[model samples]
Target chain A: MTGDGQSQARPRFEFRRNTWILAAGFLALLCAVNYFLQDNFFEPGVMVSNLTTFTPLILIAIGQTYVILASDIDLSVGAIVSLVNVVTVSIMHHLGGDALAVAAGIGAGVATGLAAGAANGLCVAALRFQPIITTFATGTVFAGLALWILPDAGTVQAPEPVWRTYSASFVGVPFVIWSLGVVALGCWLYSRSRPYLTLMAVGGNIRAAFGSGLPVMRTRIAGYVICGLFCSLGALALTGETATGDPLIGIAFTLSSISAVVLGGTALSGGVGGVLGSVLGAILLGLISNVIFFAGTPFEYQNLIQGVIVLVALAGGVFVSRGGAR
Target chain B: MSAARERTRSGPRWYRHSLVLTLAIIVVLFAAGETLSPGFAAPGQVIYLLVTASLLGFVAAGQNLVILGGREGIDLSVGGMISLGALIAGNVMDASNAAILPALLATLAGTFALGAVNGLGVTFLRIPPLVMTLGMYGVIQGLLIVITRGVPSGRAAPMLSAFVNEPLVLGIPGILFAWAAFAAFVIWMLRSTAFGLRIYAIGANENAAALSGVAIRRTRVLLFALSGMCAGLTGFLVLGFSGNVFIGVGDQYMLPSIIAVVIGGTSLAGGIGGHHGTVAGAIVLVLLQSILTTLNIDPSGRAMIFGGTLLLLMFFYGRQQRLRV
Candidate 1:
């Protein structure tokens, strides 16, 4: 029935079909590499550790996929994450990390993320500012606000055992892994849903999508809201893992997240990839870094490898899209 | 067709000239400063403003070249190149071996090569400029960190600094002289060269440009390289200003570079603006910062103000562009 609908809806199962195959093949490659690089890569214990470490990045990539799929970009997600991290710590510190207070902190953090995302959306969709420049400016503002609120490092010691064990593993499976799995599953479901299909059409061809009366602006606003929510959740996961917050910690994640999204076969042009692709992308990146860690690669070489991966991935994406016609 | 074109051009006459408006804003800012503190109106402060704005001014010029190349072309790596360039120059011309010309040339070459790598990644490797530049930025930053071991590296040659520090004829800062010379070169290139025409055509519509026999790829590559050159020269200026090469020398220039270009009335939509507007935009940006500094606002507050101004200008200018189209 889905295949019949797919044919009726669009003749381009070729794109999706090929992309799925590519993603699976890439995942296999990554797993194999991870096996050889890390001694316990296949073990549940190491897998759990990798999942916990990869959670925040995966979360950020999930949000970024939406923004990029909308044909706009958000450079400020890292800064927004930093802001959330700092704010959550400060709020929790003041509220003594009570259960209610933790919820409030996360809520406030999500609110800030939405505000930043809304500002970017308005700038891009309304004011017509280039996403790169507008987001850059707002990123600075958010980061500045973060610094202002928490000028120095501090602790947000959760009083509740449940909260304290947020990052803990169960049966050798990290809680972060579970959380990421849930978020990833939600995103995958959304991507397959009608709303996300409409979003994809909008990004795929704005003029056509607009002519179809798809409520492009509303879709864009929703995309940003989703991005904001994911970023906030990523911030929470970051806080759980680190126990302490630094306003500057989110800086490095920005490049890594972008690299992951692009590497995972998502068309930078948008409307072409799913959250599973992004998760694979994040995992691929995480594994690459893990390889570097195991191989005793210097920090600079690791950075170089990341730069190479993004370039190669981008080149691959462009090549695939053009179908070598160029 | 010409008549229709003329009508199109004339329609954008009054409101499209935002450089004039930005100039007005600068004048008002300066006048407000004068009224508030007569000391600020002194020639010294004006000279200082010119000097301080030059770095961003030059970088903005480079950014305009890339932005105008149109196909989502921007050197996010420009800021990183500036830092990397400065660091290389610093390392090469260590405190004992402060050979000026060698240091300058070496830094220029190093930055140019870095910029070329970005160009290669985009043009040859077919990476999107945004992804390519973003990744390169990180790689460059990490490399710099490794090289410097997270500390400020290299001292500016005192003689070179002094020369750069020296005022030119009419008491203008020597940095202003360098800025003017570079701007003159860019403006001349824009007006008198085949490369400039190609850039304009490519930016206007890459498909049309390709159809018209413009070497789209070559033009893009050139623009990226030129952007690198601009960042390199700006690195030298940064060293002179700071007297030491720090990891963050390129940090503040990134936003200001883009803002300067846009404020100077260059369109972010590409193919519509020039280096002249970027120079004006740079002056406007510096003036805005100067006014904020005069107000004694905290850096964070100043950042907020700067962002607010950018959003307002972008909104206004973007509307104008849309209306024209």
Candidate 2:
């Protein structure tokens, strides 16, 4: 009934044929550069701190990978994060900063993220609004809602246990490290699943996929939903990190996530690349910022230099992949 | 047979004219404004709306041109270009206003160069227009930061300030005159010029246009450059209107310009719309903004409503397309 039947029967298990080798290499290079730029770059404390910083982006970028792979985009992911963060903090504050309240807040945050994703999905896939602009509009709505919920940035001290557990280690390993492992494993399992292939097919050619009996709309919508879910996770991580509700917190994540996806070698046109590459891309971006800061570049020029580096990385990835493909 | 059905199903002659539909919307919005507050119909208020719309009109003109150039053409860098242009012009123009012309020229030239880079990447390198322009957006923004060192300084030319605020003729604001002249020139260029026809032809069907000997690559590149120039001009106007510059001054224009074009009935898929419609669309948005302000809606509520309106408009436009199909 599907092309996957024939492809699955083949002897070669060629998963990740389109994995972003260039991005992985670039990330490695940046890691090496960072090692030299910062003192004690490999120290456990520094590494944990760095990984914690990269975690939320890693989560968001991974979700964005699904949407981009389905040949769509979700600019609203950052907004979803903002909304979830504010909602989580507000809920906790309202319900009192207890264990049950924090748990309930987390649940509420996840629900809000899912709802936003569903709204974007319905508009883009069901309504057939242009993906980029639709998500952009929806993103503005989400950001507005976030601001409305928390008129301004403020701190809501989570129950000590919440931040403690988030920052603490189990068996001498940081909690973030364990969370990263869980996320990586989840992505790995999902990549091997049927829905992932369906998403890839839909992105590769929507008409063709539909003709072949794939649930095109459903797959695309699911991609967005998953993206929203991951953004919620990112928000949870952010809450742990900042313990605050800032309507403006996730604004930078929007472009940065897109950059990470592209930097991971996911074609903006879609149907290529994977989460692994996006993870590497996210790390690369984080490291680039770190290196800039450590190198003592004027604080003002930091963004300028960072932008230049992303462009260079993007161009390099494109050139290398095109060269390799040819 | 399907094509015939599409033609018939397009309904009345007025329905087929998106510009008419947009104009009708403008009238409706005006009526709503009047009903909500009688002062909305005042000549002064109308003039204010047109003047602000014209500022947005400049940016939308460039955006419309790029969108009309096809192949998923969109210039996300317009906002950055606007900011860069205003910042550069503000910093360069001296107190005596002697350097105004040169500053304007330099800003436009700089913007043109940046747009050209985007054009080159999209056309030759086969980069998606969105990504290329977005990358350029980042680059321009970074350069702006580096140049301004975070704090934007300098003043708008006094002449520009006078021109913007003062009435030039018959109680009409001077900026309206500038907008009218610019709009007329753009409309003429788009309607009567070979380049304009090429733009439309390429947008309608790039492969077909190429086969028919349209300079697809050249036209697209030029269109982006032109869009950049429009942004530069918009920046100059913004500086004049505001009497100074800031890092985020141009931030608000990016999405609104696209919204104006979209509302104007320019298909994001390209081809099938005109600058005249965009003019109406710009006015409509300005009118809506004024009404919202008069109602004293919070900025967040305003943003949400604006976004919701954009989605609704897109949904309706998309439904029309689907029905035609």
Candidate 3:
């Protein structure tokens, strides 16, 4: 198989696999922080609650990983999430919150995400615009459309208790956590298998990948579509927590998701890192904020600390690679 | 004597003239506005136009410099730095003391420091410019919000305000002098300095620059720091012009700076632009906005037009580059 010689040549995958071992120590530090601060520290219920709170962000980060891994970016994901949430809530209200409306809302969210992703793909692949600029412009347009659709923020008219329970937890674990399993399985299969390998090859060296007869454009477009799907899922999860339609709700989702992706050791250069790493990175960030909350640090301090973490983590990656310590 | 040696030294000339075409487009757009609304042609209105474009002009200059230096270097934190700098300056300066120099220094220093962090991240950390600056943008925005607590405080001294708002000789706005001085400084720096040569070399080809023993990391850091300093200075100017700093001021500048840089015919991929083009680009953008406002176009229609124009410009720029070969 072409994979054998290729796999041996790549130090990145090995680095990625072994990196999780070090995460245990970081996770332990987080546990220690939580224990010292919060009363419910290490409790099963609290852990589950933390998972629930982080669900939407992790979901969005999963999709963001796909795009980032493909050596592209999607700034409109947050805007897409906002658009999806607003649209879903508005549609449910107008359609009387029936099962069909709920289904339609979910479908609409997917469609919106796909359309936005496709636009990004077209800009990147066909128009050859930079991912940053194209996505930035599309983000504004999508957010504007969201505002036009839902001019005001309001609570959705759905039966709250059912959704609250369904969204919050199932069988003592967050429903989002279970959903995480599904996403993890999918991510694992994609990343460890042929299509993902091809994607990584494409991202790592587009010219080489193209010359090797890999469908570069198709793979990239597919990556974006997958990202869009995950973003929709993120939006759906967010609906349960918010219970209201906020056209601007996902304001920092893009930055936070990217932060999570980077912290998870995903190379922004693409073709490195996996969805699981991103998920853990999201959890790390979520816990950092959680620690801040429990420690009574101001929200501003949380942001400052997060910024520091981003800087340190990014710096850490470079130093490791340079020192050959990875 | 080889074509490769010569061709590699300079990019195609016509593509660099995007600023001229951009300016011409704006003039044509303004002429259309004059036909539509005669007030747009008045001296006072034109001065107002110059004043409005000056801040963005400075931002475009900073942006173009970084992009020209290479490594996909664009400052996403320009807006955040502007807002944060203004807030820091306003909060620290005792308006009662009117210690203008110190106040401005403190603000500028803080902004420079914020920008320095961005530089350090991009250069030393090996983070991609897009992500590094983006992270800084988030950090700065968050810090600004926290410091201001969602409401900006303090006001600029009357002297500064008058200087910014009042027109200078020949009915020219004082902002024009400021812009001219800045543009001249940038032009001189790019043409004469070793640093400028490194920026050109790095932008042209990073590998080549490295092979030539250029300090790629240091140049990138300096470029990012300089961009931040320019952004900070513009923040102070913004305060003088607007009389107060507001939360939205920084975010508003982001897209305009980028749009100005690209429309000025500065390649997003870097290594081929100057302050002259950026200034022209900024003027064009300001002119477009003024004409749209005068025509009483709805905001959405205006956005569509702006976005459509940007796409069209990109297309034309792309086509011209392809044609050159």
Candidate 4:
């Protein structure tokens, strides 16, 4: 890997051997703090509610892990979430809120998500457009489409049962937990699969990967498709949580999810991290916000505080990982 | 790495013709817009668009330099800087004519310093520019609410608004002259100055530039600072033009400034574009915007059109000819 004389000169962040360890420690620390700050912090009912709130970020961050692992970024996933949410909610509304309608709605929503992912993939992998800018543009388009479908927040709503099922429990576990578990597990299994390894090969060194006869373009495209799939899942959860088709709701999730991805120990540079960290990172982010709220931070300063904390965490990770080498 | 080496000094033939192409776009947009919207080319409407275009031009100039500095050079914090600059101006001026100088100084100093921090993170801490600026964006956004107490305050001094909105000479807005002065300085620096050359060298090939004795860190930091200062200037200008400010004043310009740079034919890959095209690019963007405005599409439609146009423009000339081929 270090054979390239040219790459020797380029500085790479020497991340900790296992970032999930750091994530777990931080998560534990936060959980302990929550125990003191709030009553019944560990109660299954309260925990499930919190996890429910955390579901979308957790799922989207996992999806982002794939793209970032491939050394590409998707700025559009949040917009995708918004678009899917509106699409799902709208379809359900128009088709009449029965079980059949919900099925159709979710199916259509997934299609929208896949379509967005394909657009990003084609733009970057096929056309070689810059990932950051292309995704930004696509995200803008997706958001606009969301707005077009749902002109106003209250114009359409997911049927009561649609959301009820989301909030409802199954197999002795909450729906959020079940969904989060399934998605996170999929990410875990994929991380060990050949396709995931191929993505890493591409990300670690695109030229080398190409030279080795890897399906460089197709594998990279698959990463975005996976991201899109997760974004659609995120939208489903969000629609359930909010019970409405709100075009603008998912905008903030973009930055927050990125933060979670980084915090989870996934390198923005790609090929060096996994979904486990992202999952924990998303939960960690949720906990940080919870701590801020529990600490009674004024509404105006909550966002600022969370941003500062995340930045410090990022800078601190880099600083520590460098470990006096600098 | 080989992909980068493939880029020779002589760009595609179209690179040489970008300025002409940009001008042609502006013309076509004007003709089409006039035909579709009636009165689209009226002198008053055109002047107003140029005035707004100038506002965006200032930020795009900054974006141009950053992109030129290479290493994934992009200042995503620009939107935040613009918003922060506006808030700083609003606070320092507090609606008083006498406070204008102080407001200008504070906005410049504050944003420049903040931007430098971004550079330090990128250079010293080795944070990716996208992640660094993206984080900075969040911080600035949160600071916006805190600074504004959740609502913006202060008004544009009537005198300042006159300078921004009213023609000062030959029926041209004062802002355009101001922008011209700034653009002239920027262009001259890029073409005539050693500092300009260093950024270009650094962007073109960092290791080579470093081996050749260029001070990479200082130049990189300086570029980010300059970008911040540019965004700050736009903030004050925006305040003057609107006669007021808001938490999201600079948000609108975020994509447009980058779009302007790209549309102007500045390659996002860095090292291959210039401010002259960006200036033309700014005008092109405003013209397209005007046409879209006249299209009477809802906000959603406008956004989709803008995004669609960006994809087409980039696909046409900006992308690497192909990923594998």
List iRMS (one decimal) for every candidate: 7.2, 6.3, 6.8, 3.6
* Candidate that would win on DockQ: 4
The digit string of per-residue lDDT tens for model 2 on B213-324 reads 8778888888889889899889988888888888878878887888788777777777656777788889988888888888888978987886787787676554323211
List model 4 lDDT by residue over A220-281, tens digit each.
Answer: 89999999999999989999999999999788788878888887777676776677778888
TM-score-sorted candidate list, best first:
4, 2, 1, 3
**Candidate 4: DockQ?**
0.52
Encode model 2's per-residue lDDT on A172-221: one tens digit a residue.
99999999999888998999999999998888677778888888888989
* Residue B244 lDDT in candidate 2: 87
lDDT of 1 by residue, B1-325 (tens): 2222232233246434675787787788789888876788788888888888887888888898888777677788888888987887777777444477788898888887878888877776667787778777877877777788777878887765765576768876677877888898887676557777677677766776777777777778878887887898888778877778888789778768877876776666666666777787888878877887898887667767866776776665644322110
Clash count of each predicted structure: 0, 0, 0, 0
Using DockQ as the yardstick, the better of models 2 and 3 is 2
Query: What are the runs in model 2 whose C-alpha is more than 4 Å off?
Result: A1-16, A319-326, B1-15, B319-325
Candidate 2 has which clashing residue pairs, if any? none
Number of clashing pairs, model 4? 0
| Single-chain TM-score of chain A, each candidate | 0.88, 0.92, 0.89, 0.92
Candidate 4 docking classification? medium
* TM-scores for all predictions: 0.90, 0.93, 0.89, 0.94
Residue pairs with backbone atoms closer than 3 Å in model 4 (clashes): none
lDDT of 3 by residue, B235-290 (tens): 87788788888976877888789878777777777776666777888888788778
| Top lDDT model | 4
User: Candidate 4: which stretches are off by over 4 Å?
Assistant: A1-17, A317-326, B1-12, B321-325
